[model samples]
Target chain A: MSDHAKVIKKHHDHHAHAIAKPGKRLMHHVPLAFVLKKVLGHGGRNVNTALNLTSYIDFLLVTVIFLLMSFSAGGEITVDKSITLPNAENVEDVIEAPMVAVNGQSVMVDGTPAGNTRAIRDAGKVQKVDELFELLKRKKELWSSFHPDKAFPGVAILQVDVDVEALVVKSVFQTAAFAGYPNISFMVRKRAKAGGGEGG
Target chain B: MGGVDVGGGGGGKRAVNAEINMIPFIDLLMVTIAFLLITAVWVTNSRMNANAQVPGPPNTEPTEVTTPEKILHLHIEEFEFKLVWQQGSTVVAEDKVPKQEQTDKEFVKFGDLAVKIAEQWQQHGGHQDPSDQKTDQCVVHADNKLPFRELVGVLDAIYDKKREQNQADGTIKNVPVFNMSFSIR
Candidate 1:
């Protein structure tokens, strides 16, 4: 073969070898001394260099699904901070209605402060509080206006503190009844365990 | 996983670019996640219904009495609970559970009182009436000095006892034993 032809054949062979073995081609691009030094420096062990975003996203999806499944759907009543509901074994959830919260000091009707609990208690052996009755009466009137044809539903929720006087609670109940809210419900917290009664 | 393919070229490597179409899938997943989150919040704040009846106005007319029905009255005092079973005006069985007898060690006694009350109720044929078939009404008289927790405890005891009996009898439809109304007397 001629020298020019031989030189061309050698160059073509080198190119083909480089293309066929990409790892060797890559090694050739980087210095062998540098690669050896890195290997020795890291004790020839493979280091995790990339983050697996797919696996991370998969974990997050699983957590979200679990949270969604565990949640219970029911009517919610925003309990006031002043009232600590009595814990009961067989207590059910509160329905959607106007709430009358009685704490140690004051009574709140639908988040509005109606009167002091002590004052209401001190007002003799009364079955109703005038301020609370007025508030409930107003609510009933509004409800009646909104649904002109329908009768007043008369449902009201009483979220009372566990340590409050029973007479005070009774007064609230009677007052609510007299104000056209005859159906009264006491809101309570459900105990964690069934058939087990915990002290307040 | 991602990859790039080298296609045919003149002595040069040509990459065939490929990409995942993740926009639509990700968008759908995001929407679903958002919807699930909102639904979860709504579900967690669920409520249950409890009903109560107030005293009606005084009636001037007297009504004739037919068959006398059994009445169960539970009175919650400052440190004790009194359970009274009555048939019309006659007292059948009465029990008093003190706070001292309601300890964790003595809790069984508290429950036993409920069992005894249930037995008395059954003996008096309290469950036989057609009108009382599904009803378990009781008058709960609570003192002003009593804490609400004790009242709940007493109620729980009665309910638990009734449920236990019903389960033992293999009743198909189980109902609450004490459908209660509160009174201050």
Candidate 2:
């Protein structure tokens, strides 16, 4: 062939493969090359997908709004999974306080096991719970020391189980009162209302 | 130039549409979602407060008996609730509402103690006459063995009390009744 024709043919060959470079190819030396080859039909075409982000962006927006609405910045409390808190309609805003959790069979102060509920109940009379009392007293002292400027807000949260006896509640409550934390907040679940506010 | 027009501002005509890079926007949104999802707390916890009714410390040196003013008291028993109104040392009024056990009903209702309490309040001219604020508050004496759920039910019944409020603007408003507290003997 003539030199001019040969040069033109070489340039055309290079231009024919303009979509890809000379050696680089997709799935080159890929793991499970046989499986990939079998999955992709012999069309000799590179799979190019146009990501439809509209729906994804919409999902993200809804999620973000939901999070924003339900966001709690206090980080002051966590739900005790051991006990099921009673549901109530008349509720006030939650306050940050040391929680004294009492269950059907146990008593815990700030997640630490303190006393037994069954023994106290078996005794069958009004009495003071010593372990709970001491823990609360120490908690009160700590609260007093840390925020010296503010008045010791003598507030305590009682995370008691719904099935627990009032006697157990009374003992723990009495102990807390004796500890000088008089203002008590009974932790409860917000009762769900019917006929509305349920966003399906 | 980028969206819909598809020209990407490559030609002589000035691009009417601004090409906004959505990659960064999506990246930012993803990060925000991750942060929120990681930190989101699902427990819708709430509180029912029993403010400052500390039954006196263990045992103390004998002191002078303090005169308390008018107050509402609900002593929760196993099968009944003793509703009493007291002033100083004397009880102004007292009533009983027997609790009903759950039969076909899903929950144990305290059986309309609101009407009884209202009647008692009207007859006694009930209000907070703050001689000693501590004593003037409504005290709930729930028995040790009584389940906490019943106590909550009693609270729910009484919490429905609404007092008619006369505003300066010539409008009437309804306000909640006396706030309740707890007491242990």
Candidate 3:
């Protein structure tokens, strides 16, 4: 054989030696400790680091999804008026439109009078219960007219004063219910202050 | 024991490995924040009524302005409904719906008041001139302590009655929200 042919034969032998026998390969399992030591450094510290990374990624993913859900609400319907709303201990966040103050005597729609001249204090004069129906009916009509495609706003915020009796507040809800507006939300401050320290 | 050299493998070597790749986490957080902000903004803008047209100037001399009618302001004290109006205000009409004196329920007399207001609103002269119909806006000045329910009931009654009227007549009646202002006492 020529020198080049001899060199080629040696190279072919080396390549053949590199390929393992088919049946032996199945039995050639790396030791668990060997694999662990190689991948996770000497004392399993690297394994913990990798596990922490995986868990951290999971935590971040979950947090992202949670936050996305929290921040996606549209412009909040707000009622910026003088009427102070009664606070509740079991308060929940509710979406609403401009508030219509009902002090049990007079009705104010968006802080404007939409009813009779009934003083709140005078028990026999103004029929507030009857007036609420009128106000809700008007609001419903206005909303329907403006948003004729059934896009009328749903909830009405009632900023009933803290001193207003529960019966009066309940009447407001009843009026809203009758007016076909089922969602009536009581307005409240973030941090309770004033006379209503808790459970007003 | 399978005669494998397990004991000879270096198990005593210690190494510290606490470093973490925070790049992916930071990237994910940024993406999430951006997504939430965009969704919130989109939702907010979708609610804005962009098609609402501004009211233009009155076409000609207003009709209700010429009559100078006086509006009767009613006050609901603890027990009575009192009527109030300025001296020069034109007294269109004033009548009260008598209620059961013993009733403790704070129900607003919306239906009767609505009928009265509807009649008053209809009575305002719009038949004389076609141009004066849109300009007649009722100005209501209310006491501060009025119940929110009662007030809404009044507005609701006015709206319901008028809509009922329009539905009955089969003519589209656009009832303007009578301009209502408050005297916060």
Evaluate model 1: give its TM-score.
Answer: 0.66
| lDDT score, candidate 1 | 0.64
Residue by residue across A76-98, what tens digits does model 1's lDDT show?
45788877676545455556789
Model 1, range B30-134, lDDT digits (tens) per residue?
777776677664422222233355556688899787866667787766566687877778997787766443444212225554655566556653564433444
Docking class of 2: acceptable
Candidates sorted by lDDT, descending order? 2, 1, 3
Please list the residue runs of candidate 2 whose C-alpha ends up more than 4 Å from where it truly belongs after superposition: A1-56, A193-200, B1-18, B55-68, B98-111, B114-136, B160-176, B183-185
Candidate 1 vs candidate 2: which has greater lDDT? Answer: 2
**Residue pairs in candidate 2 whose N, alpha carbon or C atoms collide under 3 angstroms:** A167-B144, B1-B17
In every candidate, what fraction of the native interface contacts is reproduced?
0.37, 0.69, 0.08
Error of 2 at A99 (Å): 1.4
Among these predicted structures, which one has the highest lDDT? 2
Candidate 3 per-residue C-alpha lDDT over A113-181 given as tens digits, one digit per residue, 9 for 90 to 100: 754323324443223356667777887888788887776545666666544543454445555656666
- Overall lDDT per candidate, in order of appearance: 0.64, 0.71, 0.46
**Interface alpha-carbon RMSD, every candidate:** 6.0, 4.9, 13.9
Model 2, A1-200: lDDT tens digits are 99999878887895565576555356655678675665565446668856777788888889888888888886636767878777665566688788889887788988988799998889897678888888888988888798888888788889988888888887777778778987877887766533323211
Model 2: lDDT to the true structure: 0.71
